[model samples]
Target: MKLVDVGGRTMAYHRAGAGPALVFLHGGWSDGRAWGPQLAGLSDGFDVIAWDAPGCGGSDDPPREMTMADYADAVAALVAELGVEAAHLCGISWGGGLALAVWQHHPELVRSLILVGAYAGWKGSLPPEEVEARVRRLLAEAERPPAEWMDAYLPTFFAGAPPAGSLELVRSMMLDSRPGGLVPMLTAFADADLNAVLPTIAVPTLLLWGEHDDRSPVGTVAQALRSAIPAAELVVLPGVGHEVNLEAPEAFTTEVRRFLQAAGATLIRVSRATCALCGQQAASEDVPLTWMTSVEDGRKRLYCDRCARENVRSIEGKLDPVYW
Candidate 1:
């Protein structure tokens, strides 16, 4: 839960893992903390960082008027602050467009792109009628109270019932968001059309969508992304919905890990950390709050923040990392 200063605003982020950096851009409803599954799943071998984008989570809200480009700039600033020259940008929904914008403006900072349930912005990916429909729906929702807004918005995020408590979790996250920011953020993205940038992107791109994603179905947005991006890979998970990562994390995790690994994009950071012996659950920290790597293997692992300060140690090496 560390915060970085980006453009005079505090941007909250989660950092973990021991390999090439994977920066996650969350959808509109959920912020960086929503990437719990990804932060855990990918951190095993990749440096995973999820940002509470501007106007969401603990980050500062954008001014009354700001475009999608402004969001992109904040992302670029965060990446630079993290000292990462280049990283794999993974975004879902609105975050996907933000990721594209990052590649659009700051190409050097992105090694690859992974978009889930993404759009070129409504204007860029959908027909005129569909775009209009979304605008009206969003505008109407903006007028409602947070609880009502979330109640109305939540159903569209899924095809049917999702995991227990998922709906509630999303509701809580949405409520935590500021209405003023959400409206402007919505307006900013709705008008954005990065269709032209899709074909021009040189990095490897992976597009993931839920088969039953009615919100941003595969045909319109997903198909357009696949067709426009050169040699991009597209995967559709059956029974899943628009919130691909949350609704089906295991599947989403598998696709991303496989895609990045195959493209040779997830090069493990050839660095290690050593620390005083700690108790079992032997999670080691390589980059302090950024990683809690396992020491079961030969890769010298450091202590995770939690296990680091403990005075107890295993003299017999019997309390190995694998026990956890």
Candidate 2:
């Protein structure tokens, strides 16, 4: 586990294994830990990184009225901070929507997209009344006290009884979230409609959903996404609900691995970089973050994003070497 500061707020993430990075974005009310199963299951073949989105887990609370672009940029920064050039993006529910936003803003950084029980955005995918109703529901949910919120919200996540401790794990994560986060985070999609952006996505996309998903029913949402996104494929997991990854992790991993494999993506070592100042070494992709450059004579130098920031003033005055 590691933490990075994005836009002044901190985000906690878990990274494992090596290869093409597969970034997992968890859904609303949940944190990166929601992908625990996938992180462990997929780490062997890919560089899996799951982050605690703002307002959940150990991450900082959300700023007032965060928007889709805000969420997307934060994710982009998180990915850039990791030093990966491009990655296969996977998101669940709201995370799926955020992933779409990332695609719209940072297409160059995404190699492919794996969206599970996703949406274009409530405002974009659902009728006006439905969107309002959903927003109201989330707002009401945010009003509940921690214990009551846990008890009331936990059951709806799964179609059937969850294994022992599973419910507790989810409950704790949801309840741990800052109450003020729900309204803005949930309502961000209220005015967004990503329908037009679907056809423009040039990367490979896999839309996986739970057959029994009442939260974002597959027949309606999945079909709509499939029809809109060019050549996008959909897979429905029978008996699974909104928490498809948590409910059928093994199956989810199998499906995603197959999708990514077919798309010819796997974690591979990136070019390496050596800091000119401290002589520290890291993958070139991880540079700018963990290491930085300096030119003592006439050679190019590399430095860390952090250390570079500290010397931003001096770096700004450079004659030719510029800060990125």
Candidate 3:
């Protein structure tokens, strides 16, 4: 366990594993501890870090007012404090939104991103009233029997079938959640809009969705995000739901491992194309053109202050010495 003081609040985080850094962000109605299965499964091959959001588990609440960016900043601070220049990020449900927010604000710090049952905005095709009603009902009956809620709520998150023991574990995590944390988090969810920021994320992203996710359905939202982000890959789990990570840990972990491995390898290749001025790689189609521009010659023109002062460097000059 470690503590990171960000925004005047002490955030609690648990760390495990011994390889490449990987951070897991839990969804609403759950704390970092909810990732027990994943932490155990992946710890052998990766450095796993999971933290409790403000007002959840061992973390202190944020000041009276807080925004999604605040949460994203907190994560950035934690990543920096850990001395990690970049890491593979995974977020579930509400945490998925936070992960996207983090990537939007600090793409350079993320090696790869995974979003499970996440949304870009709150204003989807579902009517506001219907959305509110479902949320209200879930919150209202959260304290009741585990089996009952599982029977009712589990379907909305998974696909054609639920995994064994998933219902019980999810029920326990929900019941243990802090209402104080859940309420504010839910309020934030109601107002979240990553549509504008989505295009800005340059890191490789894997968008995972359960075929039957009612809260944030897969088809339209997932398709729209895939279209919006140039480097995003979408995967639909056949018999899963909103809590696909929890329901099918093996499948989810496998997909995440594959994506991270590929992203890491690509990062190695791009590192050799470092810009003379900023010491960062030349922007490629796989990466966003944050400080560069695409010219009419079907090539990415370098726009680094140092490189630009000397005139935009041609790709032909840089291509001779391929890094990979």
- TM-scores of the candidates in the order shown: 0.79, 0.79, 0.76
lDDT of 1 by residue, 173-226 (tens): 888877666877778888999987776555568899999888788977799888
Kindly list the per-residue Cα lDDT of model 2 for residues 104-174, writing each as its tens digit. 77765677899999999988778788998877877776677666656665556787776666677788777
The per-model lDDT (C-alpha) reads 0.76, 0.76, 0.70
| Best-to-worst ranking by lDDT | 2, 1, 3
Q: Residue 143 of candidate 3: its Cα lDDT? A: 53
Candidate 3 lands at a TM-score of 0.76
**Backbone clashes in model 2:** 15
lDDT of 3 by residue, 115-162 (tens): 888877454324578658756875775456534554465556556554
On the 0 to 100 scale, the lDDT of residue 116 in model 3 is 82
Off by over 4 Å in 2: 265-324
lDDT of 1: 0.76
